[model samples]
Target: MTTELETQIAKYQKWRENLRVTLEAYQAWLEGHGHADIQRSLRIYDLVESLKSDRVILAFLGEFSRGKTELINAIFFSGYKQRLLPSDIGRTTMCPTEIFHDPSDEPYVRLLPIETRKSEESIGSLKDKPVEWVTIKLEVDSQEEMAKAMASLAEVKVVDVDEADKLNLLNDSEFVTTTVIKQSSGKVEIPCWRHALINFPHPLLKNGIVILDTPGLNALGTEPELTLSMIPSAHAVMFLLGLDSGVTKSDLEIWQQYIRDSVSRRIAVLNKVDLAWDELKDDAEINASVERQLDETATTLELSREHVIALSAQKALVARIRGDTALLAKSGIETFERMIADEIIPAKQQILRAAVAREIGGMLESSMASVRSQFEATTNELKSMSTLGDKNRDLAKKLLAKFEEDKARYGRHMESFNT
Candidate 1:
């Protein structure tokens, strides 16, 4: 049986062989017939080769019950509910969890245990049971991963540790580790986690900067050792709350310290407000109470009341899929979307502005996202739009670099190859 490492090396070799074949075929064709700009073709090949190496990581964050995982799946997985992080009512995450990219036939999470190698041969049946840690593999992909990761989406994991309740990690747990290669594929190490959080980057997240999915302040202390380590280094803090509950006493306490005390971006999302829509008769008492809560929450966080958006994460996800901006507004998700498109993108682009010297980065920034397509068509040198015979690439390419730089400081692994 081929080792995983050997398989990976083989894959790399296959890619190289494919490259050689294509080059030989092209060169042969150009030998007899007149071909235009052979140097240009080589440069195009080089760019195509180089572009594959570019990758960014990101993380998602929120409180334990705030439906944070659900939102992550809906947005990042292209509205596909099958792929998500596992979430439920009874504290599912027992350790700090991480997810990294792995493109293969059978998807799996390499559950890495800090203490011991698990004796249980099967990874599909190790959840709920008390064990130290085990590097179990989950047969999942991005979309399927999202479904398993969040509550909003659900699918039958051919094998699920949670339902199996057959294994457990005993003590020390190091849940996440990942390495990117030239093809932008790498090994992602994951472990059995509970109470902790998920703070790693993916393709969607700028750079390798992971937007943290935190365990609301109340629950952070469970893994007391790593909480302070992770929280203090994050780029921004977002407090996800339920609209029906508004800002409860516990939520206020958490905001006052962990989220509000810091000096980066802070946002509060009023989720599940769809529940209140029918009850609130335009200007009813319940509606007024919600408004009051929004104001107070904003004041507590030193943000404008407008920053506290009352939207259904679910509805906003739907609107995004259908490209129904009007429904998004009606569903109240437009505010959240604006945060991603206008604020977050603009800010990150400002930071990554320098990487535009690279073609891939430039195209990513100038015309990468769906929303920006319309704007790029209007053509302006300042905006960096390009139109060639067959390719039209224009985008702001700076956000990835900035995001990666920011995220690296927070538990990025470095190999001592130089030594």
Candidate 2:
């Protein structure tokens, strides 16, 4: 059974493959026709490699307890028949987590330690140096083992205020109130890892989909790399807001500071719509109430109503696990998935097309110009030789000499062009 998301990604992958083949054909054409050069060959090679490794990154952003992680599970991991990532009540995903499939590597979780924050190196630079991370192997065959390993994302360590301050984990105004726990021993609790990378072999991930689950504002505020680089680089971003809490001050702050202008394809997800379900009222009443909330949320976030999605991620996951069509339909998960398939993926494809054109369009134009010049020179040489038969002997000799000179110059120019 192919899903809409799977179908769309398959089409995307096929498009990329076709583009690769076209580039290869173009390379052959240039070489066969004597237009290939070192610089042009290198550019083509880099473009093909980039296309082979291209990924569509979807980032989920929100404050804590907004069901962001649960939404991720519902969308991508419902087949495991359990919650893949730790999505508990409050502050579940402590650090930024990136989930993707790297075919060259086995299934594993690479966690960067909190102590690494003391170093001057950013998380982006640390990814290249595997020695800085703690690697945990995952048993893909065992769901229980995989869950246990993934639970480490929520792991925390208690450190004194001084150590916490040194790690930049203690922000008196924001971190203490939102992300950390103050204990009787005068120690503060913080996330054990700075960032997490999970290389799992899921179908969507195998098809070049990267899922980025980010922590709340406290972590976002402290990690400048995430705000400055990662989030903005994602192809699309979904900002979750709970229906029960509406949009809090912290949520608004996160939107303004991190999400609002970072990505072009931004979605405001109104999660936990099941909370509005009432036994005493009919479905119409419940729907009206939900729509009213959605309108309010859209207005608050200053987004169009079409971009605001309302869904219950918990119910959707349960419906998927249980194979309940009714609950699944009511959960509105299918609608959201369709939007991603129909809107986001196509938009990303257009951006990629524009970028590729900008990179290779100039080289192609130059190659065509060189071919045109060579064709004109060859035509003139043939015309000169044909006219030699009707001229006097001396004139014919001069024409032949000029024709040979032109041919030799053309050969030299071609040699220079190829080299």
Q: TM-score of every model? A: 0.49, 0.89
Q: On residues 1-419, what C-alpha lDDT tens digit does candidate 2 reach at each position?
A: 45788899989989989998888878887887677899989989999999999999999999988999999999889999999999999888999999999999999999999999899999989999999999999999899999999999999988898888888777767444535666657798989999999999988899899999988877788888898999999999999999888889989999998988888888999999999888999999998988898899889888989999899999999999898989999999889989999998998889889988998999978876876687687767768676768557677777777777777776765554444
Off by over 4 Å in 2: 174-178, 372-419
Question: Which candidate comes out best when scored by TM-score?
Answer: 2
**Which 10-residue span in candidate 1 carries the lowest summed lDDT?**
175-184
- The residue ranges of model 1 lying beyond 4 angstroms of the native Cα positions read 1-63, 99-108, 112-209, 283-289, 317-327, 352-419
lDDT of each: 0.46, 0.88
- What is the Cα-based TM-score of model 2? 0.89
| Residues 113-170 of candidate 1: C-alpha lDDT, one tens digit per residue | 4223225332224333435333334433455543444431211122232222222321
Cα lDDT of model 1 overall?
0.46
Error of 2 at 212 (Å): 0.8
